[model samples]
Target: MRSPARRAPRDADSLWRWATLSPALLLMAALGLLPVLNLFVLGFFDVRWTDGGSSWSFVGTRHYAALPGDPLFRASILNTTLFALGAVAGQMLLGFALALLCHKATRGRVFWRAVFVLPVLIPGIVIGAMWKLLLNPEFGAIAQVFEMVELEPVDWLGEASTALLAVIMVDIWHWTPFCFLLFLAGLESLPRDVYEAARVDGARGWQELRYITLPLMWPTIVVTFVFRLVLAFKVFDEVYLLTGGGPGTATEVVAFTIYQRFFTEDRAGYGSAMAVAVIFLIFLMLAAAAAARRRVQS
Candidate 1:
């Protein structure tokens, strides 16, 4: 129990902290939460623009009901899921590998870090455009390499078979550095004393990494995966710039599909329904991952 005088200053300090934070909280609620809530509610309505203004009719869950039967929606959902899984896995593997190498290197760590991080710093649009050129069938670096080997040049973005794969690869390249940064931080922060003890106990490189580094880095890895998973689900720029969700809906993703529905087709209700569903799906995935992690830890 504290004296009233001491309690008064503590309360004042607490109030001051909250007072500083309140504005940002309110702003977030207004900018983020309100729009999501509006979208959720809008999904239950048939929204239309009339000559006079706008109209909304309560249609219940028709938009959501249509999702299962809509071929485009089905394709988009599948593509988004595949994109998220593939990109996350690739990023994690390559990033962790790079981090391990960088951690062990006795020289040029800073230079390698700078080079690897450049891709992440580049804008998504720029990456898409750059990769688009690089993957070109004619005159691109890939084409040049193929020509050197007497192999056929691939029109990566123009073919249905390779469009999704190309975009996924580009995404992996663009985002791997983020995972690398997180992983490197995690690796460097690991206890040196623990490693020394492990060595004394006769642990070698692979044994130490397998039994120690991985277990300790698990949290950071999980966090990075979740962040990348969420972002990958929202992928649009690469698909838009590189493939335009084509050579025949091959690279179509949820975010791009939503943009088309809402902006191009003016199907606001259906688009809102799609957005809400994706949001729900992402939440479910994160929850599932968290539960699995907890179970693994226990």
Candidate 2:
């Protein structure tokens, strides 16, 4: 049996470790949790800014009640859902394909990785601006390409039908590299012996990928999907920079709608409600994904 005296130094060391980590833990709680708690509380209030001061009146779910009846909010919710689904789907498919290609490459893997990751390093705002210019129907690179190809120049961001799709494409371009990096890392970390055994059994490329690779990589795929879905749901920069929710609220996502409510309309409480609703919706989506993963595993 270990003596109490011997355990004293270990306990002291454990306390010292916690003491060292306390500051960081407190900082994280303050930085991450405080704002969320504040937002949640603010969602139930009617905050009005007076002369040099702000006043809060308890509204008690009025903002949440209004959400279902607000036409703009409904539109924004639809647009946000569409954007998230489209962006996540495209990103996952393209990223996984790129990962597979890079993983199987015999040479130039570093170069390909750098090329793929370049878009991810660029700021989202920059990507929005760059795509805005490229998709311009008048005197843009895409316009020039259209002219050269004897095709009509399409105003992707100007048209209501194409605006959301354009932003989704831009988001896919920007974030696919993130998925690629994750999937590639997942692929590399997979046990090589499994592949060796599959090869010895004369498993073809498609068969190995179908039977061995996908099953092994399911968790990674789920994680990437959920992470990207959350990010996609929170998309604001592309709509803000590229379309500004123009062409009649075509690209008005939840985040941009919240931004407009808080800053433009000065409706802080209602905006907070929308923000809280979005968080709840994201939680539901994550829960659904988790349930799906559990079913698959079972």
TM-scores for every candidate against the unseen true structure: 0.94, 0.93
Residue 260 error, candidate 2, Å = 0.5
- Candidate 2 residue 129 Cα shift, in angstroms, is 2.1
Candidate 2 TM-score versus the reference: 0.93
Q: In candidate 2, what residue range of length 10 has the lowest lDDT sum?
A: 124-133
- Tens-digit lDDT string for candidate 2 (27-105): 9989988888899999999999999999999999899999999999999999999999999999999999999999999
Deviation from native of the Cα of residue 161 in model 1, angstroms:
1.5
Q: Check candidate 1 and list the clashing pairs.
A: none
Model 2 spans with C-alpha error above 4 angstroms: 1-16
Best-fitting candidate, scored by TM-score = 1
Off by over 4 Å in 1: 1-16
